[model samples]
Target: MSARMQVRLWLWQRISAALLAPLVLIHLGTIIYAVHAGLSAAAILGRLHGNLWFGGFYALFVLACAVHAPIGVAKMAEEWLGWRGARVTSLAAVFALLLLAGGLRAVYGVVLS
Candidate 1:
């Protein structure tokens, strides 16, 4: 990638990580509360289904993950695997797509089911 593109990617990764930190905390907290309450799948689904706030939260979370993970992976490939150039970009694109599709699928299953 070009120097400018690399800088943009780095900035985006940082921004996405900042966004994800709180969302992940909230997610984990919700899981802990659900487990503590012994909430059934149906009960959890009841809370999520048709809730716009939950849907939005999860959608943003998924988007952040899609953006964040690929950048990290690309960096790792460059640093650890000694891979670079078009190959890394191609892999990152595929990884981002997979994350987006799977995460959105999960959001749909839980929030829109």
Candidate 2:
């Protein structure tokens, strides 16, 4: 990757990490609350259905994760696996897309179904 592109990726990864911290906390808190309340999966889904706020929050969380994870994976591939060049970047991009697709699909199911 070009120097400028690498810099941009670094910046994006940091920004995504900042976004994810609070998001993860909130997600975990919600799970704890649900479990403590003895809420079943169906009950939780019923409450979440058609809730745009919940949907939007989770979508952002998914997006942040997609952005954050690939950079780390790419870096790991470079450092640990001795990989580099466009192929590593392409694989990272593919992983990001998969994360985005799967995460959004799950969010859609919970929010719309």
Candidate 3:
């Protein structure tokens, strides 16, 4: 990647990390609160049952995961697999799509279905 592209990606990664920090903390705290409140799976599902707020939050989380993981994997591939250039980026793109598909599937299950 060009230096400018690398810088943009670096900036994106940092922004995502900044956004994710509170989200993850809130997610964990929500889980803890739910369990402490004695919410059963059915009860929790009822709360998320067709709710847009939870759905949007989860979708955002999945999107971030999709963006974040491949960058990490791309760096790993560069270091460990000695892969770079077009091949590495292509692989990372594939990895990102895989994450998207799987994550969105889960998100759909929780949100719409």
2-110 in candidate 3: lDDT tens per residue? 9998888788778778877888998999999999999999999889979999888988888888888788888899899899799999988999999999988988998
User: Candidate 2, which segments miss by more than 4 Å at Cα?
Assistant: none
Candidate 2 worst ten-residue window by lDDT: 82-91
What 10-residue stretch in candidate 1 is worst by lDDT?
Answer: 104-113
Please, what is the whole-model Cα lDDT of each candidate in the order they appear? 0.95, 0.97, 0.88
Q: Report each candidate's C-alpha RMSD, comma-separated, in the order given.
A: 1.1, 0.8, 1.2
| Native RMSD of candidate 2 (Å) | 0.8
1-113 per-residue lDDT for model 2 (tens digits): 79999999999999999999999999999999999999999999999999999999999999999999999999999999889898789879999999999999999999987
Among the numbered candidates, top TM-score falls to 2
TM-score of 1: 0.94
Candidate 2 lDDT at 78 equals 94
List the candidate 1 regions with Cα displacement exceeding 4 Å.
none
Give TM per candidate: 0.94, 0.96, 0.92
The clash count for each model shown is 0, 0, 0
lDDT-sorted candidate list, best first: 2, 1, 3
